[model samples]
Target: QIRASVSDKDLDMYEKWNQDYGSWDIIEKKKKRVLIGAASVGIHHAIFSPSGDKVVTMFKDNEIAVWSFETFYCLYKISIDVGIEAFPSDQESIDVDITLPISQSKFQLMQQPLCFSSDGTLLVIVSIVDSSLFVWKWNEQSLHQQIDIPLFKEANGFNTPIKQAKFIGNTKLIGIVSSIGLFIIVDAETGKLVYKMPKTVLFDFVEFSKDGKFLSGVPSEDPKTIKLMNLKDFIKKKLLNYLRNFGEFPEKYRILIWRFLLRLPENRQPFQSLCDKGLHPAFEKINRKYPIKSYQMIKTLERVLSCLGHWSPLFAECDYFPSFVFPFIYAWPILQTFFASHFSSDEWAVLMDHIISEDPSFIYYLTVAYIRYHRETFLNMKTIQEFNKFHEQSIPTNVKMLLKSAKKIQTSTPTEIDIPKDIIEPFKPIPRSPSAYPLFSNYPVKIVHFQKKVRDKIRREELDFLQRKKVLHELSQLHQDIETDERKWIDYDNKVSTMMDEFWDKLIKDENDHQEKVSKINALETEQRTKLLKNIQKVRQNLVHQSDAFLNKQKDWEFKLDTARASLRETKIVGHEELQKLIDEENEILK
Candidate 1:
């Protein structure tokens, strides 16, 4: 299905364009043109919903509006919140207040293709401005979830930004493409990453097959080849074949090849026309959007425009406009004059196109290669003018130098460890008894090893402190319970003793009264004395049993308290040792 934005207000659908030549000849009859929303806000991207009942379009104003496929009437208007006012807590926010909407240039580079699950239940939108993924429940009319794309640590010990993502309807997985050229698969429901291909490639806008068996996209190295591989079997043979011939190919062809590879729409105008009509509009849009533009910002933008003046007119309406220009402006801000002087307008366009679609690893490799090639020159440069002057050299020479130098960089092997004579002597003689062994027996022998071990020790100390803090808090609570139990036991004991004393005192008074009445009635006095004796005996037995049980319980609690105290003492000792070790290491380093 071919959906073309003919004008700002109209979108033309050419359903039978690919079927027959007769369909193209009678374009008016075959195509259906529908007016969509306002003409002022140009449509940036549009896609048919999975069900084919509705059309979703992203506008220049960053509004995502939905239109009925049959009627072309506006259904839903949702404004995309690309940039957040507050930064993520895990990250330290920049001092600059980047509250303004995302720039068209940036949005163009970072904007992801609109995607929907097969069931039409979920809609996913990726925002590069805030590095977040917004997923909507289309049928339910509510947001399903939104997740921030965190900087993922790469093999080179640096973080890479996520570039694009596509949904795999069959497997319930989302295919994520990173700027560094890695394919990542994540669970659609849970949002947890399930699989990440170690192999890296320079590709954009990946999509699943209609049957959901294979994934396909353009490769930067070979634009003509539509790279298709089974989702389960992502082999590197096809990608490696293209890489093998990458350096041997002519520089001019590389860009053109990339354009073909990306399947970017070919709507080229002359270089002069682009500068005259397009550059100023883009600049004016940028200027108006950002009210507080610094002189540096204006100057940087002008440099970009000046470079664009050399390239053929490619407007936002053109496919791959963002992918073509964004990378070059970003990667080499000061090398535009060099590029214009070296290559023709068409060649420059190709070069820009290649950069956006180029493998991220290769980009990193090229950067390292360039640094290696010009290390001495860069080191000798003193001022900004000197640096700019360096860029004035022919671009081909720099490019060639990097390509050649990168080949010469050999991987280094690990060095062998040499035992010190002083340390070797100590290990030569073994102690007869384990108890007589030196305290430094298991310690690091070499100074470098010792330093590393000491650093590790410090880190371990921090972890230990955190663990101890939690344990100590728990111990404090336990101690409070023990104190409360002890108090209860004391109170119980006092209550039992008071009751016994009161009973004994009353029994003794009654016995004295009965003795006085002994002469009056012998039989009644005997019976009363016997009952009092039996009661006294029963009370004594109960008191003895209660006292024994309380004592045993108290003993058990005391044992537990002792064990806790011992553990606390051990923790304190280890803490002191950690501090002492730090002090000793510092003193040794100073000496």
Candidate 2:
């Protein structure tokens, strides 16, 4: 059974979430819904009865409403106004059984409602602005008024608010822890203070054992350590009655029973206001004063969103995930205090950087595990729009779970178990000491003195051995550094040599290329010269043939001229012989 409260000026509502934990179908079918509504004022605090059949809600305006668990309806309203007259002291008959009609007129309850007792028969409320406690007996429907008990006195310098008040089991004795570190037990029936135990450190909470045999508390200064104190007759009796069956109970079962008996908070709050308002401002102060190394924190924030985005479609598309450091800073107020008190800014930054470098996902798992553990508190939230509101709310119950999961995620393996060896030997009794020859047996005092000297020498030798070990360790480290430096130098040399070889090969190739070009140029020049010479020879031969043709033509013309002349002479001779032979041929004929 879970109860959720909502309040306004006109209407105040209480919603009950009920489920049968044993039913499989109920869980599988999502058969969990908020049951509607009850009327109350602005309830500052409220709690269900031990039987879960009734709920009592306290309003800030000093109105107490009792609602029935079954029908979500208000059973009674006690408007105890502040500064109202106390219950009539002479009225003894109205202590236990109050007839509803007679005491109805005194129903002006002028205090902030606190809580109901475990049996649901008593209603404890406190004044709105003072340290006055009002206890009332719920006799059926009528609330019989009781006397007001002042938790603080005027002798004290200032008023101390009651930090926590709860009934010890089903009894009428209530245990209260004040703001000033006072743990007191009061009787709820008569509003009388029973016992007071002054504490050195102000505790956040005070709790009682189930059987009312012991009371335990967690100090506000050091909430990690829980201290238990004996109560009532149990203090005198010690553990006599409890220890009688201790041997008979199995060790495993005993731990479980002991845990059940002592019902206490697993962890204390990181700070007084971490679970409430002012957390953000305090974180802002820390951020300004001792800023964390945000490089890794930012990386982790990215990784967390990326990891969650894989599973949730909304996260995959959403731009922002929650701040990973907010929960840690809230949960580790001591760390903040230490940083502020002891560490310099640079030192703290380096420390934070180291932590982030080692494991950036540490805070991621812690925040996720905390949210997962107390997911019910976030049921009203749906989207990133509601994250601002969700971050402001506190879930103290998940602190332990968050730490456990974070540690588990960070650790690699379990520590080695220390197994003890048996003292007895397998074959014979162990010798106590090793003795030498009886050189000094005759002189007892000398032997004792010699033994002392030997012991002193042995001590000296041990000290020398330790010194040598330290020196050797330092030398080994130096040697390692030297070897590392040598390896680096060797690598550098090899790289330089390889570069030189490449440069030399390139230079050789360039030189060979220059020579090859020069040879090609010379060969081309020689070929051109040979072609020029061949062309000159061909021109000479053509000129010679033309000259010869011209000379032959001239000779032929000369010969033809001679033949014509001779022919003319022959004709002339024939004419002259026939008249002295044609003259030129006539010359030939005459010759």
Candidate 3:
């Protein structure tokens, strides 16, 4: 994490120009500068902003100070993104490595922690309060915009808190969602869940391979190890050729055959390591023992990864290695062999689970089969597209009516206003006589009040939005809170928690010396100094008690609001039917 190329002494020149150590007048349209410093509250806690322009000694939530790169001036204070629901399409990547100072008072923590994207465009931050992620873009002079990615919200479903995230292969993000054991994956650009890694799951740190062919995660798990994962792009480009032409399948079905064809792989180190270890037995036989197509093409790609070191002993060992790798590379159809060898279907299912444990993608094919095998268990997995495909020759309507027969209602009044349905078929309209009508006394009156209450509902939603987003609203609340008795908590904590201890001790020493000078002190200066000292003292006192207060009260409202917000998204998309269901569920809950 220490990326400095210059010595601390040599870094000092750029330090002042970089970080606004003293009074700095930052103006627009000037040459940029760099700065470096440590966070305030804790010792050894450091933060260097983008370009090393200005480093905040301490973090402050809601309001953040930006230092000008050129004039070394501290710029604007800004708020964070809140109440947003969208993909974080942009990135702000900068080096924002932070370790907490020994003390909590280390300059105030800025809304927890945040990181920049590789391109220095997207900024990723987390809301520890709600356990959600927020991303923002860095525009010239200030923050561009923001997107909120609330990973999941289903009550029955599981979500892992994102401990750390790193971008891999430009498009994929190797993120650790440390909830279920440790979840790691190459999250694809399209947002479809991509490579889910087991060994990489426990990786606390990850680095790309030298040639960028693989993303490697150093072990954070027991049996301390390393996981070298190839990019899907290279795997498909180089390895798929071997899977396709080398393997054989008796089945004519392309999807089914493709699955079997992926198994034929060389058992030796160089070529076999290039394949998925747990390949299908049927396919492995066709490729390793007798390749249907010459491997002249793939050897070149393997050499490319080796820096074209074909003569290297490493390649030579891989070029000719053992052929015996149990179950696989054996010249036979394992599944058929098992059935003929007397294993029952139930026994076969149990056995296959272990055999395919190394290659989990086949689990999807099994899942689809399970869905078909048990028709009544799961209903929603079949999407509208699939339903339409079966009824393809003709399209089905999005709606259907459930009725054996239809019924009509007849409203009875003393007199009926018979407006015939057919105009031309009706008898020539008979002239009405006032006397025959005979309604001089009172007429049947029906009055109903109908109103559409829209604004009230919208107003109510706005209140809910504000109430639910306390983390996002912190910036707005800071100023008001600072003016209250609670501000004492921050002040007290910062005083003791921060380097203000030195200032405090100095003041205590000079209290009486300054008291003698109090005779010379103007009323305003005396009042100001006394007020500053008292607030500083108050901040330290509160730091002592605030943790208990924060812990007990933070989760009271924060715990469920994120779930509420996520459900709100579905209701918004699904419209009336789903919204109506939402209404019924709430009413039932309230009851």
TM-score winner among the candidates? 1
What are the per-residue Cα lDDT tens digits for candidate 3 across 315-364? 22222232222123232322323221223333333334322322333333
All candidates: CA RMSD (Å): 43.6, 30.4, 55.1
User: What is candidate 2's local distance difference test score?
Assistant: 0.50
Compose the digit string of candidate 2's lDDT tens values, residues 315-410. Answer: 322222233333322323213221222233333333333233223445445445556666785786778868654444432443334455655654
Ten-residue stretch with the least lDDT total in model 2: 17-26
Our model 3 lands, by Cα RMSD against the true structure, at: 55.1
Q: Candidate 3 has what TM-score?
A: 0.27
Q: Stretches of candidate 2 above 4 Å error?
A: 1-42, 81-113, 143-151, 154-158, 199-201, 233-591
Q: Which ten residues in a row have the lowest lDDT in candidate 3?
A: 399-408
lDDT agreement with native, every candidate: 0.55, 0.50, 0.39
